[model samples]
Target: MAQIVISRFAPSPTGRLHLGHAFSALAAHDAARAAGGRFLLRIEDIDTTRSRPEHVAGIFDDLAWLGLTWDEPPLFQSQRMPLYGKALSDLKALGVLYPCFCTRAEIAAEVAASGFAPHGPDGPLYPGTCRALTPDDRAARLSRDAHSWRLDVDAALALTGPLVWHEGDRAIPADPRIHGDVVLARKDLGTSYHLSVTVDDAAQGITDVVRGVDLFDATHVHRLLQALLNLPTPLYHHHPLLTAPDGARLAKRHGAPSLASMRAEGVDPVTLVADLRARR
Candidate 1:
């Protein structure tokens, strides 16, 4: 038998736990429990514009209703801003971070003019508008106050082992250019997803990350960030996503019954477990 250390379920508290979310949470909890390992929960509420206290409360209720328990007081992303700031400062000190000034509209226009189709999760690749700026030019852009920090792809790539994430068959490589200088901090918040998640996973000592297949690509970026920051790389298992009868994978917009909603309708906890087993 293999030894299990730790696993986690991190859900954005912006929405309720739908079927997809329930499956993910149950998968993590069940795997950890079966292995006699620790299972943890994290509230990914960094996107303040969408995250609500009510939603966070609902997540707790839904998970409890499903008979899932997590170790530790649930980790909240918003409260960890200071840690993220420190990581960003470290990267900046190493000259791997730079500021990005292009707005969404400007990037769109540039993409349209270039006649290139958008690819990947974030749409069109950023054209490196700020990559070649001189010190004075950089200072001028900073003065305009329209910039957000970005990882210098060239420098970031030179730092290896962080960009490697394992799928079942093989390891996938993350080239920073594919992600195109993601924003580490935005004007709206003190930290970005890349920075916060990498820092938190390392700080919490997560050994394995179990989540939906949709996030598989994101692992590449996470691996890169983990390497750049010199954090331990956790094993990843991206499971199949639950889909609606219509064949679309379950999503927040479905309004189709959620796991909590199913519980409210009186479905037994054993039933959920059976359903998970059937799907697998």
Candidate 2:
């Protein structure tokens, strides 16, 4: 008997579902359907400040209008804070997490003053400013100021040694240090994307992690977290992003027409699905 293939398309409810989102959701859904397996939907509403209930409703409407269906009701990240907390606690027990006190402005100033900040997939990597804080200093600051919990990548790598993850038939080496000490939980939200997604994927038994190639770099960090948390690493499928006629990637910021707008304009869902499948 073959192993069951489970895939997911977890989208944040920060904005309307655009063309790129459709492409990604369809890719994950089609892959699962093709394998006679399960496709799951997850609402990544960890950013409480920006996440909107209306946008989440829009996501469901858009995916349904595109003729896509999920195996279960969507998993909302906002409701899984306890699970993320447990993962963070486990990492902390392993001495692989520390409080990061640097604000965004501070991080930028440090990077700018360095004059040669090494760039990662997300632009200038964090400078590890708070990684060297003494226990007393950390305690003192914690008493008054807010701080994020960051994964001590160097320490984590020391424990896990080296790691690799499967992307199709190829084994890719993970280089999570490129991200420096990534925040596992924020001062305000209490959970970060890296921590929540890694935990949820495992919890949901997601066997095949499918998403846009833009998140390929994020897999390195996710793989490391899996090792530290004693979770199973899933097979990855980082598909190419759909682009507009101008050859630029479709994005919410780029004013890409949303699926809702297309629906309102009387575009046929079947025709749209066929067009997207052709692009793949």
Candidate 3:
């Protein structure tokens, strides 16, 4: 038999747990149980501006209501800033992180000038205006003003060989052109989702990652980060997302029905499970 370890369901406490959240958590729990392994819960509350402590309690209550229990005290990202900082320092020491000075408006202007959106998760691809700066030029900029830190794809890839991952039945490779150099740290926030997530998964020793298919495209980037940090790449299983009747994915801002809402409406746990199982 294969070595079975731990799998985790990490949800950001920026919003209440929804049906989609319940599905992902259940998937992780079931997989770990089937493998005779451990299940863990982690709070991806790195977004300090949005992640509230009350939301964290709501998540725990929702999961508990579903009979889903984590192995220990939930790991919170905000408390792990030092670890993220160390990882950032490691990347910087390896010359894979550079400062980014371009603001949203500046990048928008560049994108408009280019007549196309640059390639990135956010759509406005970074123009790489700062990528060409010399060491002294970077120092001068750093000395005069503040800037976010971005990962240099070429440098990171060169250090870590090919950036590829197994996405379900297919093997995916990183496309630098599309992903470009993603931000690792903002001037205000110390860590980005890509950096903190990869680090936390490794720190928690997650052997399998159960999430939605929307994050399938990001698997390659996460794989690269794992390689860079010398961490194990967990088996990824991206399930179909729960969308609205009109074929739109649920958004927190839209006030989509959360698990609490559904339960309050007398929807049973079995109903939720059956609904998701029917999708697959």
Candidate 4:
């Protein structure tokens, strides 16, 4: 018997789904369908401040309208805080997490003043300003000020030794240190994207992670998290992002039209799906 293949398309419900989202969902759905496996939907709504109920409803409606069906009811990130909290506690026991009290302005000033800040895929990497805080200072700050919990990447790498994860048939080496003490929990929310997604994938028994290539760099950090948490590392397939006719990446910020708008303008879902499949 062959191992079951499970993949997911997780989207944050902060805005309406666009053509890029459709392409990603269809890719995952097709991959699972080809393998006679399961395709799951996950609502990445951990950013409660921005996530809207109306947008969440629209996601389900749009996916259904596109003739895509998921095997299981969608998993919402907001509902899985306890699981994330437990993961944080486990990492805390390992002594690899530290409270980072730096505000955004403070971080910016530090990075600007350094004049030679290390850059990561996302831009200038965070300088570990709070990582060196003494126990007494950390305790005092925790008592009065709100702070985020950051992963001590250097410390974590020391314990895990080295880590690698598979992307398709190739085993890629993970260099999570480039990210430099990524926050696992924010001041307002108890969980961050890195922490929530890693924990949820394991809890949901995901076998393959299918998403756009934009998230390829994030896999390095996720791989490290999996090792530290003693969780299974899933196979990763980062498909190319769908771009507009202008050759730019499709983005809501760029005023990319939503699937809902396209549907209302008399575009046929079947034809749209065929076009997307052909592009792939």
Better of 1 and 2 by TM-score: 2
- Sort all candidates by TM-score, best to worst: 4, 2, 3, 1
1-280 in candidate 1: lDDT tens per residue? 6656688999998777787888888888877787789999999999989999999999999888777888899999988888998998988987888888778788788878888754657777777777778878899878877678877777877755335676645777765566777788886787888788889999989888888888777777788788778898888888899888789888878675776778778889788777875785
Any idea what lDDT model 2 has? 0.93
List runs of model 4 lying over 4 Å from the truth.
Answer: none
What TM-score fits each model?
0.92, 0.98, 0.93, 0.99
Q: Comparing 3 and 4 by TM-score, which wins?
A: 4
lDDT of 4: 0.94
Residue 151 C-alpha lDDT in model 2: 91
List candidate 1 stretches off by more than 4 Å. Answer: 1-4, 161-163
Q: Write the per-residue lDDT of candidate 2 for residues 115-176, one digit (tens) a residue.
A: 99988878898988888888999999988998999999999999999999999889999999
RMSD of 2: 0.9
CA displacement after TM-score superposition, residue 165 of candidate 4 (Å): 0.4
For model 1, what is the error of residue 241's alpha carbon versus the real structure, in angstroms, after optimal superposition? 0.7
> Considering every candidate listed, which one attains the maximal lDDT?
4
If candidate 4 were superposed on the true structure by all CA atoms, what would the RMSD be?
0.7
- Itemize residue pairs with steric clashes in candidate 2: none
Ranking by lDDT: 4, 2, 3, 1
CA-lDDT, candidates in order: 0.81, 0.93, 0.83, 0.94
What candidate 2 gets wrong by more than 4 Å, as runs, is none
